[model samples]
Target: MKQLQAELHMAMLMITHDLGIVANMADEVVVMYHGRVMEAGSLDDIFRDPRHPYLRALMRAVPRFNMAPGERLTPIREARASTEHLISGAARPHVAHAHDGPLLTVRGLTKRFTTRRTSWFGAKPGGEVLAVDDVSLEVRRGECLGLVGESGCGKTTTAKMIMRAMRPDAGEIVFNEQGVPRDVLALEGDDLFAYRRKVQFVFQDPFSSLNPRMTAYDIISEPLVIHRIGDADERFARVKELMGLVGLDIRFLRRYPHSFSGGQRQRIGIARALALSPELLLCDEPVSALDVSVQAQVLNLLLDLQDALSLTYILISHNLAVVNYLADRIAVMCAGRIVEVASYDELFRNPVHPYTRALFAAVPDPDLDRKLDFAALMEGKASNPAAWPQPFCLDGSVKLPLLDVGDGHLVRASADADVSELRA
Candidate 1:
């Protein structure tokens, strides 16, 4: 695009939420919020010395490679859930203190699709699509774990299986329910209904996930109504409190989903998911679709809510930067299997697997002088399991285990691969 622009000598007006792209391509920058331009200046002037508080906050919220190991992002307007509205009755689950055990556990979880199989003259049957393959994961209590990968990498599929939104072809999902480990996959009837109240999902698309026919109030209170937990008056009060909790105004409760902006609609989704006060929140790409400034607000809101409520989140996203900002531990998936799992600092400090390194290489560096590696991206060999270098390589005859190199950091490699080789 830069080549074309230079060749044609044309002025390109590129509008996007990616600050890295803006830093790399733009000579001038314009910061806007709520249909108004807050500031406009040269790229260096705007980024290096921002005048507007909103712009400054937006930049602070973005995850940068140069940021310190355990630094937190500063959101524009921090919002926390109000726990004072907790109804002392059957509606609320018995709140328990977070223990050392995992809040959720998944083992050998696999899902496959075989409907696309076809055979000519019944000679041979097509193999099924292994959407998820022998995946195992553990979510520590009160901590955010990120499931990250490119689209079609089975990140969302794994989350769906964990939430029981879809059934897995094989494997087990276990939840530590009030200090008792329960097999989540075997749950049925009222047990399943009770489980639903314990785990809630916040979807990727705010617009599509919500029903246009329903108003914000109806959407937020739908869970409460379905469970038959609170009376009309109680539900109404809860809805109003939820609106305030998510930074939405009570006046907008009667408005339909179409009337709300992208961020507002997402707030409604978050509020709806929180209606049951679930201990686990499966947030699938919660902030990817929103604008940059709005993304900051939502990310901060999730952080604040987690701190206030002791919520455990399984945040799924393709953006490494977003995950970097929010996740305590990140699991990197490629094709259908997890390639790496490590602490936020360890993963960023040293990404061991080829697929993991490829993902890092693909991330658009915020540094204006550092250009993207189109050659590595175009080759795409690193992400292909069959083409991975050395002991990391996989083929039909070989399946490797995720061996821990050190300090709980796992990397999927062949049996012969040693820690020194991986570190090298």
Candidate 2:
């Protein structure tokens, strides 16, 4: 299109929600919200001199390669969830579980696929494949742990095991509730029900995650109905409260999922996830399928909800930018194993793991002068751990372990691997 426009001397009006594409390809931009055009100008004028507050908010929300330390994205607006029909102390202040140990812990977590059917899930075919290869991680209360990796890196598989949607072949998941530890894999009957009430999952595709036939009200209140938490009147009122909480209008409660926009549908899914008032949420690429602008809204909503409900989160995604924006700590997965774990600031500033550095290199920058380095990225050979150099290589004898170089930054490397070299 650019070539044609240059050769034929044509003017094109490009409509997109991807700010990166707009920055690279567009000569002019029109900022619109709620069916109204708020600003229109040249790309330079629009980006450099965003006069409208909405436009400024949108700019702030765009995922970027260069961000100052601890600089948070400013959401366009916040949706405050009311506590009218909620449980007692629903709106209490967030209490960090730092001193209480981890809220959830996974030890020796492993899952294998026997047949040739599931090889596409980051596994070599014609043999037993380890989809989740001896993974272990922890989540603390009121903190967001971002599980980030490339596609088919077992991020979702780990999340599924945590959610108990799929049975893991081996591993013990311990749920620590108020100083008491319960084996998650051995949960039965009422124990399972109790466990389910404490954890909920939000899926990637909002449309598929929701029942197309069910109305918004029914969808949001289904968990309540199933749990027998409240009567019809009480549930309806609760549904209304949840809808408002997610910034959805209660007037649309009678409408089906298809009638709502992508962002709205995701909000509905979030509201449904909150119906049971779960303590932890497993968000599997929740905003990946939405528009860029909408992604900002949903990310902000998640943060707002976390603060209001004191929620713990395991946000799974391939997008590092999203993870950087929301995560307190980040765990990097590569080819079904955790390669690194560290606070957001530490990981971004000084990535010790080879794969983590490669991931950062792969990220597309919106800066005009800073083009993507395809050569270095291809040479990184990030998919195959066996191809890595020296101590980072996973050859026959180079067993890797999570070694701390400095300040709780864990990187998987050979025991004898020089931590100083990796840190540098």
Candidate 3:
């Protein structure tokens, strides 16, 4: 889309969550929040030195590979220290201590969809599409595991299976609750209901995820009402507590979702998710729809809630920067399978897979000193699995496996690839 705009000599008004796209493609940038322009300036001026607080927060929220280890992102609204009390009684049992192994383990998960093809004259059966193919990964207790890939890469599909919103054709989803492994797929009735209480999801779009007719209080309290966790009085208290926890004014509880901004709506969603105090939070591109400034506030709220609640997160997003900001480890998916899994720093510093390298190359560096590699990008061979060099390439007949490089880092490559030779 960007290239076509440039080639035609057309003025492009691009709207995107990707700061990389903005940095690389935009000559002038306008930052907006709640349908109002917060700041406007040249690309260099906006990125190099942001003047507005919202703009500054937006810049800080973006995860740069060059950041020092342990650098913390500054949220727009800094959470209050006293908000910890909101989560005191709401936390689920057996989540306080760090487990010896993974909190949730998915093994050989596979999901295929068969579509029916329809023509003008007639309809016929379509071939099966493998949405998620033999994918396996683990999410440790009290840590955020990022699942990243382009659209149609199966990140969201995998998350849905984990949430049990959709059942997989094959594989095991093991939930290790205090060393007791419960098979998620095998659960029924009360067991399934209990599992749902232990896990909750925050959706991608705040606007659509919420009900327009429902007030903020009704939306957040609906979960508690469904679960029958507490009486009306207790649920009302919980709702107010949740509002405070997410940095919202309690007075707005009676206001409908349409009255709130995108960020505020998302906060209401987060509060709703926390009503049951689930141990595992599956956030599907939670901040992708918000403005850059609002994105920081939501991201920071998630971090603060994670710490206060001891929550484990499986965050699925296409934005590597957002993943880098929150994820302790990241799994890069391609063609319905994970191609690489590594710690944030390790993956950024030494991306081994061709696709992983391609993704890193695509991220635009905000620094004035560092420019994008147009030559490398123009090649465009890295994303094509067929174009990868030997040991990384997989012909139709080759049996490729996810091999361990070292230090817990894993990469999918040909079975014949020398593991030691591939170590960075």
lDDT by residue for model 1 (271-319), tens: 9998988899999999988876678778877877786667899999988
Global lDDT of model 3: 0.84
Q: Candidate 1: where is the Cα deviation over 4 Å?
A: 2-13, 27-46, 50-57, 76-100, 115-127, 369-378
Tens digits of per-residue lDDT for model 2, 1-424: 7669999999988887777667778777898889999999887888778899987887787767687766666655654555344335443444665678899999989998776545557644557667898898988888999999998889898988898889999998999878789899999899999899889999999979889999998899999988999789988877887888898988898999999988899999999999888889999999999977678789878887887788899999898988988899999998888999999989998987778888877776555555455565647587688887767788654558889989888998889878888889
lDDT of 3 by residue, 1-424 (tens): 6678869989989887657668887899998878999889999998888898877776676666666777777666664423656544655434545446889999999999999999996889989888898899999998999998877889889999999999999999999867889999999999999999899999999999999999999999998988998898999988888888898989998999989999889989999998888889999999989876578788888888888888899998887878898899999997788899999989988888888877777667665555667666538776566777878886554547899999989999888788888875
> TM-scores for all candidates?
0.88, 0.86, 0.90
What is the lDDT for 230 in model 3? 89
Ten consecutive residues with minimal summed lDDT in candidate 1? 85-94
- After best superposition, candidate 2 residue 44: deviation in angstroms? 6.0
Candidate 2 colliding pairs, count: 0
TM-score, prediction 3 = 0.90
Winning candidate number (TM-score):
3
